[model samples]
Target chain A: AQSVSQHNHHVILSEAASLELGCNYSYGGTVNLFWYVQYPGQHLQLLLKYFSGDPLVKGIKGFEAEFIKSKFSFNLRKPSVQWSDTAEYFCAVNEGAAGNKLTFGGGTRVLVKP
Target chain B: SAVISQKPSRDICQRGTSLTIQCQVDSQVTMMFWYRQQPGQSLTLIATANQGSEATYESGFVIDKFPISRPNLTFSTLTVSNMSPEDSSIYLCSVPGQGRGYTFGSGTRLTVV
Candidate 1:
């Protein structure tokens, strides 16, 4: 069985402040990492994913994440955040290559204050 | 983009009753998945809905409890039979993305009282 852990349960930041949310997964085999964001009253949307290739992947809204295999982490970062970024973010992992099952982290609720 | 639409955005149901949530996709997809999200929790996969075949349920989930239907590529349904207070959660359907990502429905908020 595989599991994901998010270090932060809640994060508070001011507008224009840099942001970083930690995500780590426990799986011995090859894994696929993903970050999904759910805004208030909205469905979950993909922020970015790391399937293969570049360790650093860029996503929408100037957000990016780096996959550090040694650390077993794929932390999401943004140079600057806006008040609109207030949402709940989740880290997910696919246990293996073939199956589509995704094990998700507990989630981090970020509040960006203006 | 693969668009997915789900019905009955939110509902309040009595315990021991059943609620069927519907999902419709704009394009044909090989796989449709059903997921359950408890309040303020991560998404947990309930089962895989494959067209023309029985659903593949994950560990701790059974067919009779969470019966699913996938009549075609673009349509699927999940029925929560004999619901209980513990069954109160959000039910969502997802389709495989072109890049192997997933496009999820808005989710059905099920509250069993």
Candidate 2:
């Protein structure tokens, strides 16, 4: 079975700090990767996705993730995070050919202090 | 991306009661999924709602506990039967987006007491 792992369980940082959340997946075949964010008292929203082509994918809100197939990792990064970026982030994976059944990782809670 | 409308954004229910959550999509989609997110946990896929057929449940989730109805391409419902405090969580509905990504509904947070 496919699984995703987020190494960081909780991260606390001051504003303007560089952000990098590590995500690794266990899958042998082609896969689609995604990063999702959930604000306090809100629903999950897509931060970025990687299907094919370039490894670096930029998403809304100044978020970006790089898909490194050889490493089996798709890590999310932000040059500088703001206090508004405080949210829970989740990394998900789906078999490329399998419609959209996602396997998610334990989320990482980010607290950005202003 | 498709927009999803989920009803009863938050509900407080008594134990042993049942609650049905509804999800309506703005556009037709081939795949509709139901997921459960327990407190401090990742989202777990509950089942895949198939149009005109029985839903396919994932491991640890059974049809008896989570009955699903997918009548068409844009609508589905999931009913939690005989809920307990353990069932208190956020239930979300999702659909495949145009880019092979997913669009999720504003989850329904259930609290059973």
Candidate 3:
């Protein structure tokens, strides 16, 4: 069995502020990491993913994440956030051989103040 | 990526009733996944539907409660039988895309009264 842990349940920040959301997973096998964002009244959308190669992955909307294998972490970060970035973010892990099934973290609700 | 169209979008039903949500994909896929998102919670996989075969349910889910129909490679349906307030949530369908990504539907919001 695999599980994901998101360090923050909720985050609040002003516009132009830097943002970082911590995500960690527990799986002792080859894994694929992903970040998803769900805006208000919208469905979940893929932000970015890390399957192989360089640990640093960049996503749509100026978002990015770094996969640190030693720490078992895939934390999402943005140098500057806008009010439009307010949404609930989820971190998910797919076991390399688990038939594409994804295990998601609790989620972090980000509120960007204008 | 494949596009998924899911409906009704939303519905309100009385207790003990049932609601069947449908998903139609633009392309054929080997497996379609159904997920449940409870209030303020993350998504949980309910089952995996494959054409010409029975669905494989997750640990906490049962066939009787969450019946899935995968008649073909491009379409699937999930039925929440004998619904209760606990069954009220967002139901989504997903299919694996190119480059190992997954594309999701808009979701169905079911409310049991």
Candidate 4:
């Protein structure tokens, strides 16, 4: 069975601070990676995704994530954070070619203080 | 990305009652799935809503508890039978699109008393 792990439970940062959320999955086969964001009282929205050909993938809202295959990690990052960036972030993974099922991490709650 | 919508965004029901949640897709899709998100827990896949056939449930879930119906490619429904307080959570419907990514609905938040 494949599972995803989010190293942090909660993250608090001041505005303009750098952000990094670590994500790792237990899977040996080729996989697709994604990051989704959920603002307060809103639906989860896709931030970015990695299918192939790129280790570093850029997403909406100034967010980006790097797929480090050797490390089995896909970490979400941003150079500076804003108060509006406060939300819960989830990292998900799906197995190779014909895979349609997604395994999601426990999720990290991000709080950006002004 | 396909737009998905779920009805009864939030609901409160009695323990013995049942609630049917509806999921509508803007366009026809080949795959639709239902998921549950318990408080502070990772989202769990409930079942794959199969078109014109019975749903395929995941481990720890069954049709007796969660009956699903996919009448067409663009719409589906999930019913929580004999609800309990433990069943209180957000129910989300998702559609698989290009790149193996999924588009999720706003989610239906259910609270059983």
Tens-digit lDDT track of model 1 for B17-111? 99999999999988898999999888999999888888999999998999999999999999999999999999999887877687899999999
Best by DockQ: 2
Candidate 3 TM-score versus the reference: 0.98
Best first by DockQ, ranked: 2, 3, 4, 1
Per-model lDDT = 0.92, 0.95, 0.96, 0.92
What's chain A's TM-score in each predicted model? 0.97, 0.98, 0.97, 0.97
TM-score of chain B, candidate 4?
Answer: 0.97
Q: Tens-digit lDDT track for model 4 on A1-114?
A: 999999999999999999999999999889999999989889899999998987999999999999999999999999999999999999999888643778889999999999
Candidate 1 lDDT, A12-113, residue by residue in tens = 999999999999999977888999999988899999998989999999998999999999999999999999999999999986654477889999999999
For candidate 2, the TM-score is 0.97
Residue B20 of model 2: what lDDT? Answer: 100
Chain B TM-score against the true chain B, each candidate:
0.97, 0.98, 0.99, 0.97
| Each prediction's fraction of true contacts recovered | 0.60, 0.74, 0.60, 0.51
Q: How are the candidates ranked when ordered by TM-score, highest leading? A: 3, 2, 4, 1
Best by lDDT: 3
> Of 1 and 4, which scores higher on TM-score?
4
Model 3 whole-model lDDT (C-alpha atoms): 0.96
As for DockQ, the candidate ahead, 1 or 3, is 3
Q: Is candidate 2 or candidate 3 better by lDDT?
A: 3
